[model samples]
Target: MFNATECIEIQVKSRHALDGRLEAAVKDLQETAMRSRTCGILITRHQPGHYTAELSDQVPFGITRELCR
Candidate 1:
């Protein structure tokens, strides 16, 4: 848990393994992206006094290729 004013950074302790038996994942949503077998970590940032957060899922790539450099 984090406080409103906290400046926090999180690192993925492990690479999430893909579960073929897991439910289908949506390639479009950040949440779904987070749940992706390829995803590494989900991150969030918040402002002080207000725990409003920004969440991001890191896919870093699609089937054929990742986003262009």
Candidate 2:
């Protein structure tokens, strides 16, 4: 079971300095979540990857217009 009450907005950037891209990403996410004190993470990426993970649960990818401002 999962709780949806808490969340964090995560922005992912590909850095050349990090070893093992995917591994670094997961570690970074865990560290950021601990420091920020959040549960759910809304992840966005600055650089496109060769592969992408899609959610089976019908979460919208588009942001609300009000939030665009």
Candidate 3:
């Protein structure tokens, strides 16, 4: 669960295969959330080469979730 007002969402999209961009994006967002003292990070794969990273208060601190759909 995420509160819209307290959640920060970042979208990552890449066209190339075998690129590490997605992982890098996730790491970056996680670092940012930690620095901001936010709750945790959520990563969702919506499609090929597309992902959404979210930092929100609903997630427990120091936790991360990788979801695929």
Candidate 4:
């Protein structure tokens, strides 16, 4: 339902909830992004500061991280 764009996969999780759910969370985000034809996706935790992770598509992880940051 949405156009593909270069963006990170942002997920919010607390200090406790984030444990043992990284794969599921990232998979969900990737699935959602794929449905929307998203160009890329990045997985990160919920925190007060900036963070970056690997991207799922052609775009480099660093570039996506920089753009999101």
Candidate 5:
């Protein structure tokens, strides 16, 4: 039983083309979701250096997918 409106979304940005920060951000988001008892995480790449991580019941737990804009 989860509320879609209660979903959590986080934005991440990196200047370098290849950086570990983006992955780290997703990991951090996962940990936060675990701590909060939330299920599922979505990663969306808006551009080369921008991304968004979302926690929502719409996605299955332990699954990650890229959303197209």
Candidate 6:
């Protein structure tokens, strides 16, 4: 089983700067969640390949007006 929670993440890609990019993504994800009405539980992860984004089951992506704020 997997742990579930609410979240929204913003991810960016970097070729030579993996650590830096992950760090930035974590910060960006927090900032993105903080500025909105979200509960601010975004989980940021860095992979060996392309960067990616995700929203949890409790916060699935869709037409949520508050998500923009």
**Residue 62, model 6, lDDT:** 32
Q: Candidate 4's residue-wise lDDT over 1-69, tens digit each?
A: 433443333344564444335445455556655664644555544453333344456654222332332
Best model per lDDT: 3
TM-score of each: 0.19, 0.29, 0.57, 0.35, 0.59, 0.38
**How many angstroms is residue 63 displaced in model 5 relative to the true structure, after the best TM-score fit?**
1.0
lDDT of 2 at 18: 30
lDDT string for model 6 (12-69, tens) is: 4555575675456555555555455343333434444444333334553332122221
For candidate 1, the TM-score is 0.19
> Per-residue error at 43 for model 4, in Å?
2.3
User: What C-alpha lDDT do the candidate models reach, one value each?
Assistant: 0.27, 0.35, 0.63, 0.45, 0.61, 0.42
64 Cα displacement, candidate 1 (Å): 24
Instruction: Rank candidates, lDDT, best first.
Output: 3, 5, 4, 6, 2, 1
Question: Model 3: residues >4 Å from true position, as ranges?
Answer: 1-19
User: For candidate 1, lDDT tens digit of each residue in 1-69?
Assistant: 212232223232223422211111222233433444353222232322222112223324232122211
Give a tens-digit lDDT track for model 5, residues 1-69.
434444334444545632465566567667766765657777676666566666766677777777866
Scored by lDDT, model 1 comes in at: 0.27
Ranked by TM-score, top first: 5, 3, 6, 4, 2, 1
* Clash-forming residue pairs, model 5: none
Report the Cα lDDT for residue 64, model 5: 71
lDDT score for residue 21 of model 6: 58
| Residue-level error in angstroms, candidate 4, position 15 | 11
The model with the greater lDDT, 1 or 2, is 2
Superior candidate under TM-score, 1 versus 5: 5
What stretches of model 5 exceed 4 Å from their correct place? 1-19
Name the lDDT value of residue 9 in candidate 3: 42
